[model samples]
Target chain A: MTRVETQDRRQQAPRRSLTRRLWRAAPPGLRQPLGLVAALVAAAWLVICLIGPVIAPHDPLAQELPRFTPPGEIAFLGTDELGRDLLSRILAGARVTIGLSLLLVCLSMLIGSVLGLLAGFFGRWVDETIMRFTDLVLAFPTVILAMVTAAALGASLFNAVLAALVVSWPPYARVVRSIVLGLRGNDFVFSGRLLGFSAARSIRVDILPNTLGPTLVLASLDIGTAALLLSGLSFLGLGAKPPTPEWGSMVSAAVSHFDKWWLGVFPGLAILTVVMSFNFIGDALRDALDPGVERR
Target chain B: MSGRAPVIAARDLEVTYPGHPPVHAVRGVSFELFRGEVVGLVGESGCGKSTIAKVLTGLVRPAAGEVEYHGRPVRPLGVGRRPLAQTGIQMVFQDPGSSLNPRRPVGAQIQDGLDLAAKRARRSGRRSGAGPVGEPPADPANVRRVIGQPADAAVSPTAARLLPAGSPGRWLERVGLEAADQSRYPRSFSGGQRQRIATARALAAEPDVLIGDEPISALDASTQAKVAYLMSRLALSQGAVLLFISHDLSVVRLIADRLLVMWAGRIVESGPTEAVWSNPGHPYTKVLLGAIPAPDGAGRLPLVPPSAAAFDAPPVIHAP
Candidate 1:
């Protein structure tokens, strides 16, 4: 084969996602392995979510009709306060929790990434002004910070998402800003400008694509945290109301029947299973994407 | 050189980055880079030289006219997306250390690209290392014989089926490094040493063309000569096309067989290195030749503003 063809053959061998293709193309020094893996894990989580609802065994919300029963027949994790199947409720709840968490994270990343790109690319007094504003928000204790937002907006799934996003986006914005600071001065970015990537497209293509390697991992890890925060809000009666089958609200209802321990145990277990698995996936992804990072 | 195919042939190219009415960085640049022959691109800071470098490599899109590789409109001036011809071309960036992920180890970093290429041949069922993008090492004995090494020895690849052609250690020494330095990160090495490592890494891939965008620009003056010497050594040793880009005229003069000059996205002058240096015709060409500071600083002069006539005059075109 001609040398280029040989090389082409070699490169053609590896089928990859857009992220992997982009990462592989970067010089060895620029590859941040842990960050890539984390992002991949997040993407995998989304994939898992896509096929999950169909495979869930029993209806996640099918009531057992026998109240306070422990792991037994007709119900996997036993019954809740209304004699509902715990496993059923937990399985069904994964759809909304995973779906909404993704939505909130996506919206947050979009808003934060764009703002960061604007702040970073324009740099000047504009950068300073936006940076200070993010800092002001950052100064607030995050949980308490999200609380005030939830209160002002009034509690609901969508509103909680908005509140969480307001709290979450600053970190993404900060990360993207720093990255843009480095990228904004690069030859490629300058080349993009010269090539007519335009100020916006340059940031969108040259800058934004690079930022995702890190930002996405953070967003993935943040999903589990965001879910927890939303759950915690619900536990405090700031989330979805009864019969909504929300994990946090179910946990909240379990409080009234403390003597019936299965109610609290099952919901808490559901939260733990989803959160822990996501955390593991995040860690694995960080490892895989950053094959370069020296594993600790 | 003229008979050989011109992989990259450009005529009167211009580049303007968007800004206040757009800053015209490179104007009327033109040249032909032959297949298997290295063309040296040189100019001072903000002269639109680097812009031209990116234009050819497909990393930077050009704003006007044609940048053809093998008669294919690889990256037409103002092409919206990267084209196939451009995709075949790859770039070895300025800072090798910074170009890599800070947190990753060097082995995997190298392995990452190798792995990606290997994965592509999944249907071919070729194992990762000894495929088309890479070659089996030449016999270890050959490397030892070339460098007269006593420091180390290993199994020769002369009879091997899949490894690259030579011993990795001797190759390191060939690139002006000790075998021990192979295991060390680029950070532990000096600026010159790091550059040498980058050159070695680029050499490892055995690419069709190597575009060194000021590969030695980041090194100190004292170290530049050796690094330059090592690059020439590797290029001759491997016979890969070397397109050395630098702003240092003195440096470009030492290594280039053919010299291509770019000013504000246009080629003001180009010819055999000796020809362009001795008999520069274009005004910009004369400016560049005269711009070179003479020994004892006698020939040194400040940049004179280009007269309005120089600005308005159509760019000079030098087609092969």
Candidate 2:
């Protein structure tokens, strides 16, 4: 059982380790403007999420003395209508917004991957039942589905996560199902099946490896979608509620005091920045993982 | 005949997967199998040679037909389910790397069959007392988890196949491989070497029938010959039936004992290798036989003309 285990362990490394190495050793072709932009944006998002609360000058929720205090020594991103430091609030909420979106993405992938493995690997009744169920869930727009689920689960971050997980898992399941459907009857799969691999086991073990390139691409793309959903939910006052320093909730709170442009501008920029970072990362990952795939 | 049952006998075999406008992959492909007989299935790509292999190996279900083992009909198996009857029939695929689980360790994948055989032997071996059917106590799921089984329920019958109880090193040796090479991934080894590993795996299963679906097609010309020789030799020594499917007429000409020539999913000719090679009665076989390049000193052999115009287009590159 231990044969070549050490070698395999070394081969199967952390993605972050790989990305870090890429950053450290930027290849000659990779040292371009766009690559630099994408890498920095992705790395910055990770750093911001990791160290957001520690370095900010003021409490994100603490109000400043004056509203609309344009970029000054005291405040970096100016002041909101409530006189809160825009920079501080943006910094503070990075953890909650990015963290929750990522969590939702992981949860969705877990559910979708398992469901996809079952549906694809076992394509009779199990395939039909899972596909029909996913389609039923996909019948509604993600926002609408999240809205319904959140309303039922009650308005909270956890509930918003539930909504996102429920709404987003189907796309992954559908993609994986399609990949499985294509590869299940292939010669290699037949060999695996003949070697005594059961349907579920063959999908997970044999089929999933070859299919993970697309699955990873789908999961990466879903991170941005999940973030947008999180922000939208918060903007509607269903996520994180208020005063907990969420970008979406801040935008929602900013709406009440329409006179102040800084409130809307700062939170809006924060949401855009985080979402754009993930979108850029997804594109970069797709290219790095499959150089053969032309990004039209 | 040593009074032993035939390794496999598929009668009136048919395979049809409903596609857009419906496609008939294999239609009424019937053949009898015997222990230690190497039956060569020759046809062009998409001619359903692989499909017949899938059907015989229990990887694909026949829409209509009777598949029998030892003169008895066997049930169909699917993705998540495999019948006990099929555990003894193993397959070696063309793409060696893909057949192996990339996420798993190499030894574990080979051990998968060994473990399964061991477990099954435990159940049946106790009653029959076949001197411990496998070397050691092995579990299929334990092997499967290493091959990326679901997080829950580590090993299940649906997860992986188990090899026998102990010492896979010997199995490696039997396949003409050294013990040092057992731990390497399929990617790490050359194509010929991987095929050897695949052969070792099939041997570990101790299958009644070894199905080779173009197992040598993916290898280099020289390597293909070596692997083919190894497979036939090992198959004979193990006393297992070798069902070799290939599109390479020359390869089959060298390796097969009995030949079954197929086209458009149905067999056109079936008989002894020498009979089919020297006197191919079927027009299709005759055309194919004429196409094979001859040895030096032989005069310029003329190309065979196609019987039908449609057949000329997308011509068979290598017809067995």
Most lDDT-accurate candidate: 2
Interface RMSD of 2: 2.4
lDDT of 1 by residue, B97-182 (tens): 45433333333334333333343335346443342222222332211121322222221233233334333444455555665444
User: What RMSD does each model have against the real structure?
Assistant: 14.1, 9.9
TM-score against native, each model: 0.52, 0.79
Residue-by-residue lDDT tens digits, candidate 2, A75-152: 877787667788888888888988998899888888898788778877789999999999899898879889888988
Question: Deviation in angstroms for B307 in model 2?
Answer: 6.1
Report the lDDT of model 2 for residue A71: 72
Predictions' DockQ, in order: 0.04, 0.42
Lowest summed lDDT window (length 10), candidate 2 chain A: A23-32
